[model samples]
Target: MNDKREVFYAKIMLFGEYSVICDSMGLTIPYAHFKGELSFINEDKYTDLEFAYESNRQLKKYSLYLQKLIDDGELIFEFDLSSFKKDIDKGLYFESSIPQGFGIGSSGALCAALYNEYGQNKIPNSRHISKKEILNLKKIFAQLESYFHGVSSGIDPLNCYLKHPIIIQGKADLSTVGIPRNKHDEKGAIFLINTGHAGMTEPLVKLFFEQCKQHSFYKSIRDEMIPFNNNCIKSLIKGETKEFFKNLRGLSKFLLKNMEPMIPETFKEIWNIGLDTSTYYLKLCGSGGGGFLLGFTEDLEKAKFELKKHNVELIPVYKNAKVIDTIKNI
Candidate 1:
């Protein structure tokens, strides 16, 4: 491209996907392997002009949505709509490698890139977002990301903007935090498996809402699921490997028994095998119907062997130990 700037990285909500809405603990971290940035089309750097044109068109639609937010007084910060239009007309597009609907914050990266480029006044993307500034950014990002997923948690976008590991204690509590360091040869790991298709967040979210209408289902999540979710986050942060896996198994089993629809149909058998053998445990990466399924194990080699029979492979995210302030190879 002629020009590219303002990079935004992908995010993984490691724990507390849907339960975070219920005021439960959630943890997220930036995944530098996938990212997006603002770029111009008329350049010798790219071989795919059509992709850039399509991205430009999508950005045009998003700009229109943002304009409406401004016109209706819903926008809280200074966004330069006029400048944004000029760039779009000149063939501005998002150059990205992040996969959409993968629960890896593709749209969140786009939002971060856009806001970084067009926002006149913005929250500093500081590593130590140890103050109330996190909440302000969350609120703004929630509104910006709503255009993609009808109801946004804003956590994904905030994760992209901050580019740090964030711990969410509840609705009113969130701050960037440190994670334990891992060795290259460590056995315990966090990993992912591709489910072979994209999952629609809107539909899955609607399904979750519908399920919540049933008191029994909601109570199950509150009493059963949230505890598992919260404890996993707690143990992982504290570097309590034994405790983390204990809670992770609980979380995976709970998903298998109750939130089955979130797990893709084809992988259900394999998911069961993980729980039965205790070689590994699979959980919803995000709103999981089909996309990436998050997996955890105390032993990566054993998990790989178990997954091989299913014709699947695990991609390790974190290994050994250590919370990254800025991410490197996982």
Candidate 2:
């Protein structure tokens, strides 16, 4: 009943899943196939009445949480809490298609939708957004998104809010950049394999942190993943197909060896076939464990054929220079 709402698209991280944890370059983009928006539930219009009501209740709880943080001086920014509360009273819910716990940035989109609708003195999403503004927004968003997950980097909401391709050169260095576009003639593709379940980010992330405690494992991250991952990102943007896949193969192999727990149990055989036969190489979409597994192949059809026996289907996110589909997530 207030102002019109805006739909926030889902985010996908193409590179730097674990490397980002070590302050390496990370790349994330928006996916239009999945999206969310703040909406009010009307009896005649609301089809998922039960979930909508539940969402409203959650929003109410979130509003109170925000208020508490503000009052306690934990969060300094101002929000139109009164208006947000009023909307919740009217069955306000997030109308979204982004799958939760699938590493597609479901909470990130919701956070972006809320901040856009309620936050005061907001940085507008414009054509010329500066690095400083981006950093500031990430700082604020981290606090806001923490209500959903205990500790968030705020990168997920950052992607959903900016709705552009972001590249992180280091921990604090971030900027929007143009990615290589897919060429119609190119057959090579980057894709996603749905694991048919949600991934618990906490445990997998904990595992990564725990692994990092080991000298050899942590050394591999610094020596192996960081270089391979950064080069893959660089080669992709420069349209160097050969170099890109070279590093991609290294990155994929490293994950298979070290991050086994993150990969679903049933997917191991096909994952190896890609590595051995070169049909397609798979990597963790997010923290791993479950959700979507990112895959790359020279031929999409061949990859699909190889996966058919495993009962796995891929949603292509990129092909050559083009964006075929989108994701790593928020």
TM-score of each predicted structure versus truth: 0.95, 0.94
Task: Provide the lowest-lDDT 10-residue window in model 1.
Answer: 321-330
**Count of backbone clashes, every candidate in sequence:** 7, 10
Task: Summarize candidate 2's per-residue lDDT along 1-330 as a digit string, tens digits.
Answer: 446678899888889887798899998888788899888887456458888888888898998998898788888577888888888888889988898888879999999998899888989976379999999999988998888767788899999999888899987899988764552227888788998899888777878889999999999999999899999889877768788889999998988888899899988877898999888999888777788988989888899898886787899876663563232222
Q: Which pairs in model 2 have colliding backbones?
A: 12-327, 12-328, 13-327, 13-328, 105-330, 181-321, 181-322, 182-321, 182-322, 262-289
What CA RMSD would you report for each candidate? Answer: 2.2, 2.6
| lDDT over C-alpha atoms for residue 33 of model 2 | 80
Clashing pairs in 1: 179-323, 180-322, 180-323, 181-321, 181-322, 182-321, 182-322
lDDT of 1 by residue, 22-82 (tens): 7889999898888888888876565378888999999999989998998899898899899
